[model samples]
Each structure stands twice: as C-alpha cells, then as structure tokens.
Target: MPTRTLAGRGRRFAAALLLLAALAVFAHPRIEAAGDALARIDKAALAKLTLDEVEGLRSVLELRASWLVAGPLATLERLARAGIPVEVIDRDPAARWFEVTIGPEPKGDSRRPPLADARGREVPQLAPVPLEQGVWITAAVDQAAGPSTMPGSRVIRVSAAGGPALAVAAQRVIQRVPAARAEVRDDPRIAALAAEVSPDRLRTSVEALQSFQTRDATTTGALSAANFLYDYFRGLGLATRYEDFTFPGTIDGVRVTGLPATNIVVTIPGSVSPDQVVVVGAHYDSFGREQTRVFAPGADDNGSGTAALMEIARLLARGPFDFSVRIVAFGAEEYGLHGSRAHATAARAAGERILAVLNLDMIGYTDRVPEDLDVVVDTASEWLGSRYIAVADKYAPLPIARRLDPLLRASDHAPFWDNGYHAMLGIEDAVLNNPYYHRATDRVETLNFDFAAGVVRATLAVAADLAQPSRAPAPPVGPSARTGFLRSLLSRVKLTELAWSPPSDRAAVGYHVYRSPTPHGTYQRVTGSPVTATSFTDRVTSAADQVAYYVVTAVDGAGRESNYSVEVDDGTIRR
Candidate 1:
C-alpha cells in the first residue's frame, strides 16, 4: 500500500489545479531538472516541503495524466495514490520490459522528443516511468459462444487461416463484463459474402497504410490516407467523397490550418428510401501519440478496420439493399474524433434517416485474451447492438462480451450515440491490450488477419441485414421539406433542439431530418424514429459533436420518404 498524508494529498490536488492553471504559463515540454520545476513553484509558501518531495511534485507535473509503468508495483501504487492519474497499461511477454502509457501533459506542455528504447531508437509508446519515486512500480477473446462468460467473436471459418492460440491474458478483465446472448443468424447470403473476406486482402491493405509513415491528423499523411481511400473506393465503382473538417484549439492546443482532416465516404443509394442510411465506419488516421512527430504503424489500431471497410465495399457491390449504406473512413480519430463529429453534426441538422452506425476500430490486434469480440453498447444503441451480438451467434457464432459503458467514448461510434443515432462498436477487447497500441511497433507483423477477417464478416452480417438486399430501384423523386425551429438544448456547449416546418407533401405522415458537415457529402439521419412533429431537439454531445447542417423531408403515409427541402445552417456557437 502507498502512503498519503492529508497534507500531502491536499498539496497534490493543488498541484494538479496549478498544472491546469499553468497550462497557459508553461512554454517548455522538457523540464530540464528538479531546479526547472521548483523555479515555477512558490516555495516560500510551502516551507514544509523537501527538495526530494518537490522533485516528485515536478514528476507529477511532467507526467500529468501519463504514467511510467515499468518499475515495481509498489511505486505505481504510490503514483496512483498521489492523484497522478497514472495507469499501468500492460506487462510485456517476459514481464521485464513493461509497456507504459502517460496521460497527456497539460495541453501546452513542452513538446519533448519521442520516447526511445535502450538503443536510442525512437519508439513510440516506449517511455520510462520517470523514477521520481522509489523502486517497485505499482502494477499492474473470442466470440466463439465461449465459456458463456463472454460474447462470441464475430467471424466465420473456412478452408484456410487458423490464427495462433489466444493468450487469454486479458480475458480476466473481460470475464467481469456479463455475457451477451449470441444468436447466430444462419443467413446463407451473409455466409457467402463473409467467406469472401480474405486475410490476404486484409493484410495487403494494412501494409499499404503502414507504408504511409504517419497518419497523424495534422500532417499531410492524413490527407494522403484519405485520398488513398477515396481512390480505392472509387476504383470499386462506388460513389466516394471526402468529408473535410477543421480543428479549433484542439490540435495540440494551437489553431492549425489546412489540418487536412477528412472522412472518406462511399455511398450506396437505397432502393426504397435513399435518404435512410446505415453507416459502416472506421477511422483511417493513425498516430503513436509518441511524440509531436513520429511514425505510427497503426496496422492494428485501425489499419485492420480500414481494410475491412475496403473489403466490405467489394463485398457490398456484389449485393443490393433497401436502405442506403455509406462506408465512411474517418480522420483525426486519435485527435479526439474530429472527422466523425463534423459528419455526425451535419447528419442531425439535415435530418437524415440513420438506421444505425457500425463503427470498426482497432479490430486487428488479437494478441492477448481468449474472449473473441467485445461489443460496447451504450443505452441508445442497445437494440441494434443486441442484434449485432445475435448476428454473431446466428450467422457467424463466436464468443462475445457486452458492456453498457456509456462513458467508453474512446472511438468514433460514441459521437453518433451522443447525437442520438443508434450506433455501436465491434472491437477486439473491451479494455484493449495490444502492447503496440499507439506505438511505432504497431505494425502488420503483430496483426492477426484471420481474426480480423472474422470481425469483418460479423460487421457484414449486421450491416447487410440492416441494409437488407433490394431488387427494386430507388424512387427518382423524393419528398420536399421546409424549416420550422432550431435551438440549443444546453447553454452554448454543443447540444441543440430543432423544429422544422412540415413539408407540403399531402401524402406524407411524418418528417425525416438529414444532416451533413457539408452540403455535398452524403448525409446521415440522427433520429431513431420518424418525427411526428415538425420540431425535434438535436442532442449534440460536447466533445467533437459540432453540428452545422439540418434538412427535413416529408415521409409519405405509404412510408415512402421525400428528398430534403432547403438545407439550413446552424451557427449556434455562442462564443
């Protein structure tokens, strides 16, 4: 156990607040030594503190939310007890070289060079847990209708590619999450399409993305990645477009221009209601978050998800659907889901009929844990999420686990849920333990293509079912719309309430709203059901949920929906 005197605790809390206040004061990333830290503190007021204790305080300031997890478990406990916000990510294979993750040093903390190993080779995610304290760091898959303790993995097996024996290293934590009922839908059509998901092809895509050097949203690499996706989707004969966006003070605390962030979209028009959309999403951008400038082979973090999107596109072109399916590869996910927010915000404003959003993120690294797949279902997307679990059991039965973690908003899917769109995530583990996650070594070598193939298949089953194969062509004419009212649900943070004038279409029974960050990009609906009234409040989530566009369309009494009326832009930001 670690010790924490009441006075020391108060001092530590004050230090954290000071750090928050000092965020505007600090200009340097590297605090040269203990002296550098003390120079900034008011030592005169803290006569009870020792130089050594102050060094530890400096470490706290430098480390901020990050932790150096290598040393002894005792040391780690002390750091945690100190209100350092540190976490022990994972232990290495041998348990000698522990992998650690330090939280962000306040927004404007100095930009130090990237972390390096003993050889001085800069490796992202490899950092020393500054030995400010003593020794002793504190410490510390599959959907196979597995043990009934976890959800089955989303996948199908066939002629080749059996993955390695799972370590089950991370399953202990997963077991704590209740088992979800898996109902494997025996959709032969889905099986055939899933069988088409190849490990070889998936591997090829990861390799191509890894070749990009870096996919940091603020760098040119992000745009390159977007363009690459745009071309690939276009090559598949899909109508693809780039959903461009901007990052305010969010980009490393500086206003960056030409951040070059965007989400790549491939739109497949619905045969009936072309406006009703089902989104298949994955973030394309990658970053080690290792250093201000670093190489992140995000092969596992998201390369696998992006590859799945590409392969899914190939698979979808083979079939038809009644609902529109838009394949979106988002940008700036590592930088707080910038691209998805812009897209989600616009979708709400336009009142697009979004059936569901299936976000695939970090689906490759199946290194540890036996639990096959973990589906994070928030309160909003429960129905769709439960079906996703059932889809795994029905069509591609695999072990699975479910967690109703509303705050598990680490990926792109959360933004949709925040905006009231039914969305969920298909991930390898609820608490991801890919040692190379957010690291330079997160390369193709560590990826399990066979497992990735399974995740892709699972997504296909659900998306295909939701989209539903269609033999009829879409109606050339859609309903028209007119605006009613739109306002903020909260103060000025982001959430908003909107009301639209009912369309003039006489046959229409209700209205559907569509939103997009831009006027041209394919729009997505934010409502779960058709709004019986002309007024609907748009509940936008704060982090990254900046909505701008709204359009309402009349839904015919026959259930047929119309084209959008004139689009409206909401400049609701008070500041």
Candidate 2:
C-alpha cells in the first residue's frame, strides 16, 4: 500500500482492489487467486496503471474511507491494519450500502448523496433516542451545512450491542462512539427437527409468490397474497386469520397515513403451554419506486422471505409445539413496516406472551460470489439473535457475520422489538446488497434458491427449538359443531338463510362462515367478517342452478379456530 499525497491534491487512488463485476458472479479458484494477488499490491503493481486508468477504476471501485475498495468485506481488515482510520457514517441495510468518512479524504467526485427522502424532506444523519443517555441513531443532519471535505465529516456517534467485532465497528465509525462482541453454540435437539426442511418446497413457494404482479401495500396484490397464505394455513388445520391495518396510520413514527395493508396470520397452538408463543414473520410486500400498478416483481426483496416463511409453516404445521408458533406473512413492510407495527401493538396491548420473533427478510440473494449470512441484532434482542446464530451453526452451511445495528430499524422485526418482544432478522450478506434490490430486475432468476434454503433451514432450527412442537388432533374438540340451511326464492333471486349453534367452548368469540360450490378446496367467505351471533341471513342472485355447500368454524380469543360444522346446502340444484 502506497502512502503519499500529490502536491496541493489528495492522492488519486484506483478502487479496483479485487472483486470486479465479472469476478463477483462466480466463486472460482481463479477469482480467489486474483483477490489474493490484488490484496497485497505494492509499488511495482501500482506503477503499471496510468493515471487515466486509475481514474477509470471508479467504475469498479468505490471511495470508501481513505481507500478505493472493491467490497467492504475485502478491504476492512486491510484498512484497519494499515493504520488507516475509517469512520462509517450512514448505512441503509435495505439498500445494502453504507457511507463512510475517512481521514485524509481522497479527491475525486465526493460521493455525498443529496440527503433527501421521497417527499423532499432532509434525511437526518443522526437523531437522539429517548432510551439511554448519550445514545443516538442516524437522523437527518443539517441540509444547510451541505457537503464538507474535512477528515471527520462522515463520522457520527453510535452505541450498539451484539458481537465484539460489531461493537467495535459501531464505535469505530460513530459520528461519536460506544461498547462491543458475542458467540453462540448449537442445540442438537433442534438440528434433528431442522433436517426435515424441504428445499424443493421452499423454491416452489418463492415461485408462486413471484407469479403475482406486485404486492405493494396500496395494491390489491397485497390482499391477494394474504388470502393465498390464509388458505394455505387453513388447509393445514392451523388457526388462521388476516390482520388488517391501514398504512401511514398503521406504522409508528412514520408521518404518512391511510394506505391498505394486511398480514396473513397462522398459528400452530402449543400442546402444553398454549399461551406462550413464538413468532416467525416475513414481509410479503414489494416496492418498485412509483411503479406499484406495473410489474415490480419483488422476487428477492421479500418474495424470498414470504416463500421461506411458507416452507416453515408447512414443516411446523405437521407438529404441535409446547409454545405456540405464529407464522405471519406481513404486508406493507416495504411501507415502513406498517403491518407488523399494527400486529405487535395489538399483541402488546392484549398482553400476548410472545417469546421470540425470527424475521427472514432477504435470504434468497447471494452473489454466489460471497456466501455469507448477516444476522442483524439490536441491543434489545441480543440473546435471541445469538440463539439463531447457534442454530445456524448446527444446520446451515452459510458463513455467519453478526452485525450490531441498534439503529437499523428497517424490517418487520423492529416493530416486535418496540412492543417489548425478542426479535432478530435472518438475511443474506448485509454487505452484499443485491444489485437488483428494489428494482424490476429483482426477479426469481436473480435469487440463489439454494442459498435461500440454507437460510430457511437455519430459521427452522430456531423455530423448532423455541417452539418445541409436537402433534395435535385432526379437529379441535369442545366446540358445538352443528349447522343447517333454509332456502327461499323471491323474484329471480334465490336467498339462503343460515344458522348454527354457538360453540359451547367458553373461549369462543366469533364464527367464520365459508361457502364453496364443490365439497372441498377453494372456498369463499360468505360473511364479510366474523359473525358474533350464531345466525345470519345470506343473499344470492343467480339464474344458474347449482348447489352451494357451506361450513362454519368457531374462533377463540387466542385465534384458535375449531373444526368446521357439518356442511349445509341450498337444496340440490336442478339443471
């Protein structure tokens, strides 16, 4: 590494240390060899490139700290040892990027992003949290101050909790700094359960999710995705429901309001301690930068997460747990985590005993270049985060990199943490922010399904250990299961009156009515919402003569749905 500054000018260094675009796609021996050779570039290698070539390197490298580095992972250790001071400033895990300030700032075009959000509001570089004294997360820095070329302009203060490397890194780049490290081990009981995870199912689920045009919070796609998950869980005999909330008003701390968002919720009740619960959540929403109506194919942003969640649901549904496991396909997470905030707030208000939440955000991306898993943990959920890491050690092949991002509140997991629940996120390498993220290019083809499966297996390990699932009967007991239908015709319209005895169970809160032309499979809800009373009037106008079969299921306070009552019909239709 050369240490020199040209007269009246900062050194113009080329950033192509290693890992260029073509090399980034494959993890081959040739690429590895090139990276090794490039890592130790001396005066001899540096002289071969002309100044013009040095300037052209910007296409492949980025100005990070004082060094023009290929990737943070490839350069962080070298920079640290070279005695080059590095200060990480602003970082967006969703965007999979970070901004840093290094002393002896290099001269090129300073990559100071115009700091403003969608509404033209200045994005804060730092803000004080009401938590502990001297703690601050990145908030909007003063816009008037503009850009400064000073050595420490990018440095800001931050305090975080997690592994030692993370703690140290947090302090090293803070516009100001705080404390550090952690380790985890395996639980074999969980590994045996994780072994049953089917990678084929995981890929199939992702493919199904990507088939939708767009799952934006404001679009009908959101509802459609939710309904699909609802039916899937319902078929598995698990308690299922749709948790709905409007956006803007739904998400906390966000000023925006009145967008539609719904979370598909499914629960596998604990056999013994049914009240104790564990949550495995994933956001199903996708964004395309003002292209909600068009194709925003969110295959990786969250289609991967949503798909992985389904695989977990399918696996866990086969067994009953000691602690109830609720798998939620959260909507509007792309819209500032509105769906989750709504659910968590309600869960907290109702005094639900949520033991832990494992959120899988973007687990389907791997440059295939760097196979790493970034388990993001905050100060609040360090223990839960460590447990997940230990589980990954036992069942997953992806290398783990624990990052302490106390201020990184970018996913569904954050809302659970706010509601005083232990939550952690499982994601692809945070450093390798997928190139196709948030774009129309983020399709299934861009995802590494094999890598995603490993992440799911790791998550399944965590869920199995925490929930400790067993088995349940085909249909739950203690609910009154009787129903009848009466038909009447007026004008050209046919009306069917439906009635059912209330479930004898003390916990019964409401009943859900389902109707379908066939005996099984696709069923539609006749009632707009859950009916509190046992009787209801049904209206239908159809000239076609065909029989419609109906069934009713009772729901309890904990969202448990009883077995369906006997089917009722509007007298067999005569053709």
Candidate 3:
C-alpha cells in the first residue's frame, strides 16, 4: 500500500490542487506520490487549521466507516470542528477494475455472462473504472431477467460482435442505441492518398506473416515475427525498436510465469510538435485451438489489420507531419492485451501527449455485397470515432457501424482508453461474420483485399489528418463562371456553373467555390463543403439577369486551403 503525510499547510494545498487538476482532465484521478506513511492528524488538530487546510485534508485523506456531508468546504470545516474523526481506511489490495462493453444476457444459460468474445470464450475486459457512471466490478451470476445492477439500465458483459447474443435477451434490455450514419465529404488529397494504398502490398504483408504459422507469444515464431516487423520498419529508414516485456498467466490448466513477449515500435518524428503523438497500432501475435499452437495462421483475425498499419506507415513516410506518428505492432494481445496495457501504462507514467490512437484488430473478411466496417469507442473518445467515420466516408466510402461503449475492451485500444487517452477500434465486422475467427485455417486467401485496402486507405487518411499534413496543396487555376437552368421535378431552377482547372500539386483533393456581388466586394463561400470536382453548380434566383463574381481555392488532404484563383464573373452580367 502507498502512503503520504499532510504535514505542512502549503504542501497540503498543492496536493489538493493537483488532485483537482487530475479529476478535471482524467476519469481515473490519481494524486502524485506523497510519502511512506499516512498522516495521523486527529479531528482536534484539523479543527485548529484554516479553511484551505481543511479542504486540502479532505481531498488527501480517505474517510473511515463512511461519513456523508453535504455542501461546500465551509460545511466540511464546521463538521471537522464538531469533532468528526478523519481516519484513512487502508486501500484494498485485491480490488481490480475492468471497463467492459455490455451486451444482453445469454439465453438459457442460468449463469449471468462474464465478459466474452464472439465465440463465447471468457476474455478479460480490463480498463480504467468510470466512476461518474457506475459500472459492474464483479461478475453477476445466476441472475434472473428483471433488471441489471449496472447504471442507466445498460446490459453488461457481452462482446460487441455478439449481435445474436443480444437478440436472445432483447425482452429484458431497456434500451439499444441505434447505429448512426457516417458523415461523407470529398477531399482530393485524401482521395489521392487513399488511392496510393496497394491491395497487392497489403496481401503480400499478410501472406508473409501467415507463413510464420504460429505467432503465439511463448512460441519461437513470435520472435521471428517481431524480427520481421523490426526489419520491415528499419528498411523504411524509420526509427524502430523492439519493446520487450514479461507476462505471467494460465495456459490450459497450468499457471505460467515470466513468459517473454516483444512489441515492435516505429516512430516518425514530426516537423512541428514532435511530442504530441498519433498512434496506429495492431496486434501481431495470434492464437488457435487449445491443443496446438504450432499451426495457428491468424490471417483475417489480425494479419489484415497488421498489414493496414504497415501500409499507413508507408503512406505517411512520404513526408513528416506537424505531430509525431507512432506505429506499433503489439504482441500478446490475444493473451489479455499484455503488450498494449504495458505500453499504455508506461506512456501515461511518462506524460506522453497522445492526440488519438487508431487501433485495428480485424479489418478484413467480409461476406456481404457492400463492404462494411465497425468502429468502437468509449464516451470520451466519441469524437475520435466520428472523425474516423467521416474520413472513411470521404476516403474509402463504406458502410459503417459505430458503437459508443467503453465496455468493448477486446482490442489494443482498450488499454489506451484505460489510461485516459483517446483511442478507437476499427474492425471489419464486429458480428464476427468470418468463419475462421481463431481457427488454424485463418489465412490470407480468406480475406477480401478490396475491403482490406479501403479500410487501410481510410486509416491512412485519418492518421495523416491527425498528424497534421505538413504541405498544403498548390492553388487552383483557370477559373470560369457561367449561368444555366436545370429542370427539376418541381420547377425550373436557375444556377451558375463555376469551373476551374486542377492544381499541379498531387495533394490537391477538392475546391471551395466563393461568390461576391462585385469583384471588389467580400467573397463568401458558396459551397457548403469542399467540392470534389473542378466544377460547381450554385442555385440562383434567375439565370437571365443574375450576376455574380466567383473565386475558387484548392483544398488538400489535411483540409488545408490554398490561395484563391483569379476572379471570374457569371457572364450573364459582367462586373
């Protein structure tokens, strides 16, 4: 147990301020290391101190036997003077917290479900405890179908991929959040970057890893996989290293200790703020049936995602960004996310400023006609998911299913979320539509390259956007404007058609059209969003007499806008 003393008034005040700052920013509030022993200050001693001292002590000390007091610091100080003993209860050593995604209860099974995967295997759902919104700490067993002890009447302990499992207990569930639509827009630079993603390259990377057979953390193949990834990144001339760790857990029925694992880390230092990081990570290790670890070929399960990470690294390697980008190939993810947890914990301790983490788990193997993807995030990181969805729509254009549940802790992103960092999980299909989730037959051939490439492109676009694209697209040229009429179902609509030539810079993605009453007057943006094409159509009151001056500017992949093109008139009535 850790202990601290509240000796000096100034020291106590500083500690209180630190605690308040932690509470404001982070969900898991923690005080800085205090000392080796707890302060034994009695109620009478506290009564003699000032109001600031009393308030400081309240935050620094733990209450014993549960005493409740309402209102502000004044009330607390009064109560302390009235002889309330301020004692600290020893913290529980066995207490552990998990942040889990809640699905409906399992059907026919009398036992209430613990955290599980799509296949109903018991998986650890470890994350930081969300205190404001009460969560389940212990596994509920043998509970009936009335009401859940979890807050907001939300279901608990089911996988995000287990859609069928939720249907069984639909009657008992109070609420189900409907999947929201992804925002769509066009960016020529993003589209260009996305187009650069090679389906063949993705396949080659996946196949190379699949050839290793088994990448279990304890197996020799795991070391080979790590070396391969290290060499791959090193070949790119990026700063790369192997982050090593030791883990202890149960395999079969026997307890194992000090098993070694390796995480491959690659860093691309930013041109501007190098300390602020954008993380792209995926687990490289895999698992199979209990009997044999030698034949596990985890292609679709994680190979697709790992390949996506490599492809993104390749795209971003073209140039440096405003923020540092860190790519990690995590090991031992199947064995309770040991690699990610260790990394996230160390990052938090070191005060690494992480902008966002895009964690890919299984981003291939779709059976449907239109390829779809699932993005999972917690309450705090919903913006990160929204940005991912928006970028996917613009860059990849695919069906997306979004889940805002922190309880979905099956992947590497969970550890980042646990440490109070913004992270999201991008998966091919959360429902586990693939037949070979954890089987030995999981191979590269089973993965849909079309779907995998699109996912990779989307991930690349977003990662670049977060890292802040360093170069702005060159300004567009050859602007012209003309009036036209369109026959709609309701009536004839008059409009102005603005056209421009593409920029010389390959980074240019789209154009933003602006309008002005006079050539010398203020130009207002006419288009709501960036237009993908070089031409734009703006609806007008009348095509016959309406006159407008127009200008266009080029927008790049990072949403940076270049200088406006030379002004042009509507031609109906020249300025």
Candidate 4:
C-alpha cells in the first residue's frame, strides 16, 4: 500500500512539471513580441509628429498587448523645445512594467523607474500577464519618486488603474524627442542686401525729403510753407539744415535784396554706407496775392506734399539703416524752381552721389479727371519710377495709372533732372483740373481730405519701397507760434455781438472801423472815426451798398491801437 501511494505522488509531480513547461513556452513569444515592438519604434519620428499622430501611433502599438507602459515624456519634450526644462522618471523591470513621472529633473536622482505607491510603499498593483493564457496579474508601482513629480502623473495613474493603458502611456512618454532646427545663413552680404530691400527705410527717406517748405514773407500770414517744413522735420528729430539762395533779378526793376529762396535739407546718417544718398524733395511756395498783405494759406498747393514729408520723417526717425537719406524742401518753386536749381547745381558741383529724387507737388487735390488718376513716371527715370507706379498699383487702394507725360516739368524734380539726376514728379493732372488754382477760394474746406490722406499714404508706400532706409520720416512743419495762436483763437472766437455802442460816462477814445470783402482779402479804412459813440451813421454810403463787413479798432489819444472788436457782416443792403 505504501509503494502504491508513492507512485501516485510521482505521477502528480511529473504532470505539474509538464504544465509549467508549456506555460513558459507560450509566454516567451508574447514577451518577445512586446519587446520587439517597443524597440522598433523610431523615437525621432515620434517627436517630429504632432500630438494627434502620436496618439494614433500609440493605438497601433496597444493592439499587440493588453497593457503597455507610457509616461508624460512626449509632452515634456515638446515643452522643453519650447524653452521649458524638464526631467523624466526611470523604469524598473522588477515591477512588472516600466514606470515614469514628469517634472523638473533634479541631479543625483536614479534614472531607473520607480516601483511603489505614493507613500513610498511598494506598488504591487501592476498586473503581470501569463505567457500561455494572456492572463494579467495586478501590481502597484511605488509613488515615492519625489515631490517634483507632476500631479497630472498621479491622476493618470488613478485613471489607468495600473493597467495596460498606463503602461502604454508611460512607453509613449519614454520615447522623448526633439524638433529639428532649420539652418539659415547670417552672412553680412545677405544682411546688406536685405537692408537695401527694406521698405520702411525707403519710406523714411521719402518722408525726410518732404520736410522742406517755403517761408511766408510777411507777418500777416505768420507762417510760410518753409516754416511748416522746418517744424515738421524738427518734430521728427531729424538733423535739418538750410541753404539760402538769392534770386536777385529785380521784380519791376526794384532792387529786392534777400528775396529769400531757401532749401531745407535733412540728413539721416547711415549705419553701413553713409556716402550714398537717397534724395527726395518738394517745392514749398504757393502763388497768390502779393508777398506782402493778405494770408496765402497754401495748405493744399504743396502743403499736402510738405505734410506727407514730415510724416515720413517721423516714421523714419527710429531706424537702424545702412544708407543715408536726404530730404529737401525747395523754395521759390512757384517762382520757377529757383531754390531747387541752386540745390541741384551745388550737389552736382560737389559730385554728390544721388540715387533718386522724388518730387511731390500739388498732391492734395483729387477733384477732376478719371477717378483713376495716372501716376506719371518720367520716361527718363522709368526704371525706378515705374517700380513706384507698379508698387502703388499693387498695394494702394486706388488704381494708379502709369503715364509717361511729356509735361513733367511742374516742380522741383525738373531742376534735378536738368542737373542730370534721376528724378520723377508726383503731381495731380493739374493742367486739366484745379478749379481753385491761384484763387482766393483755395481754402482747406475746398480740398478732399480723404483723397489727400490717400495720396500721403501712397506716397509713403512708394517711398518705403524705394529708399529702403530705416526710420520714419518726420512731420511737416506747422504754422509759427504767433500764426498758430492767432489762427486757433480766430477759428474758435465767433463774433457774438457787433452793434455799435457809445462810450461810458468817462472820457473815451475814438473808434476807427475797417472792412474787407473776404476772410483773407483787401481791407479798406472806414471814412470816419466816431468819438465815444455806440452807433456809426455812415453818411457817405447809400442803402444800395450791399454786403458790408465791419471791424472796430479803438484809437487812443497817443495814437495807440486797442484790440480790434469782433467782425460783423450784413447781407446785401436793399435801398
């Protein structure tokens, strides 16, 4: 009976051994397949692809097994590339699957994966699959990796429940990757070429050119076009200077000394090539009544151009450029380009290197002609001039017509061309349009502000495309202090009351009233000086005299003048 029991025990032992052998064989292939799949992964490719692609790849990897190890490495790598520093946790085979945590990697930390729960206890929850039946046993990884480990990593663990998904996520993260940096040359020649093509710089040059204007000759119109340019350029922080040229040939044989024809010039020093100059200019004078009385508010005639120049200067002031830009506001243009002639002549005599000349004249008016006005490119300087027209057409809101007119001799550019410089004139088709030309009605209200703004914008664009200099052009000069104050005060101060009033009981001065037909026109002295009287009985005029304007200036005993009272005008008087 003892022998029989022994035999049975042996049989049972052999059977158990055989079963264990078969299980080992079945499990080996699965382990190998999983290992091979993980090994074959191209980590670099994983890093280059977007997150969506990586997720899809993870799905494909997961199909081969029930559980996989993954971590937050993929996200860490992306963040690192974007200038964040990070560290990845290591893995341990003893803990069924690899483990990983993401955060700032500190020095002296073990590169191997952790294998315990959050409280430094061994996480035996990780499930191990049997080689034969694909059955998994659960086990937990230790969570005492460090305080630096991210909270998201812990959340992922809770969601994964320490299963294949967690392993897959950890594996996905383990494959940390980086993006490839693009290679580019930083050669000085290339930088120079780039500087040459910079549109902002060129625009600055154009703006600087716009900063010269003609000065008013009298106190009545306290500011001249030239003064406007000065203020504009100075406001832009440009180093501006002037050249006064005398046009002494007398008007009507009267010796007119210092018939001031001046050119306002501004220079922007270059960073690399300061010797080469990009030139731009416009005339600042306007034609109207004599240069003595009455204000010739030449706001649109060339003020538009001058103002545009000033704006350019302001734009170009903040630049790091490679070439010099020169702006000139030529005076005596209305008197026939005398100032420009002097400037161009001097430049030629000095053998100055002038690349291009952009002349802006009458750029404010946009009344007649096709709504699509042609931007005339002088046939002589078509190479650069055509580019301006083309750029304007390509970028400008308005259609720029490219015309090669034979009559481009309207402004300062003519003198530059006569001096053999490359020059182009920017003008409206003034020959056909300009109803207010040299007329008393040429006020600011008569001009199109929108059209003026467009021209300024277009001119700025063209200038930007050409000079390729750095910095914004300056603003055009404004009216003088006295003029500005007077104008501002006059504009706001309406004539509230104009009834003639008698002086009070105390002895008072006599009142001499003057009158003019227009705001800025001829004024005639009234016939009588009324004494301390409120009402003036005009004994000289009949009731038939229509349209009377009156202003009262008080004259004291010593022939001193008081402030002129408010002006009053009555409609045409009917007898």
Quick one: how many clashes does candidate 1 have? 80
**Evaluation by TM-score, superior candidate among 1 and 4:** 1
Q: List model 4 lDDT by residue over 1-575, tens digit each.
A: 00012223455545543454344333333332221121112233333334333332221112111222233334333433443222111222333332222221112224435555445656433322221121111222332122223232211111222122221222222323111111121223223232333333323433332232213332212234455567768777889887887654234435354565667899877553456566767766555544323445555666666665665565555554445677887776665567887898888778876767777776656675334444554333444455555545544545555554323455677666545466777666534377766654445555554555555555555554444433222111110110011124224222222345432221236666565432212336664554455434332222222233455555555655443333344322111
TM-scores for the candidates: 0.53, 0.52, 0.57, 0.42
Worst 10 residues of 4 by lDDT: 475-484
Task: Point out where model 2 deviates above 4 Å.
Answer: 1-192, 249-256, 470-575
Query: What does the lDDT come to for candidate 1?
Result: 0.58
In order, the Cα lDDT scores of the candidates are 0.58, 0.57, 0.63, 0.44
- What candidate 3 gets wrong by more than 4 Å, as runs, is 1-136, 139-188, 290-292, 472-575
Residue 300 error, candidate 4, Å = 1.8
lDDT of 3 at 553: 81
lDDT of 3: 0.63
* Model 3: residue 460 alpha-carbon error in angstroms: 0.3
Tens-digit lDDT track of model 3 for 1-575: 01122235345445544453344334212323232111123323333433323332221111121211112333333433455432221121112121221222112323435645435556443322221112212222211122233333343222111011111111011122222333333446666788899999999999999999888777888889999999998989899998999876456655587789989999999764577789999999888874336788899878888888889888788755656899999998877788998898789778887878999989889888677788987644665777787777777777888876555667899777656577899987655677888888788888889888888888898887667665456656657777777776666666887778887676678889887643323568888888899898888654333346687888898898975555566765311
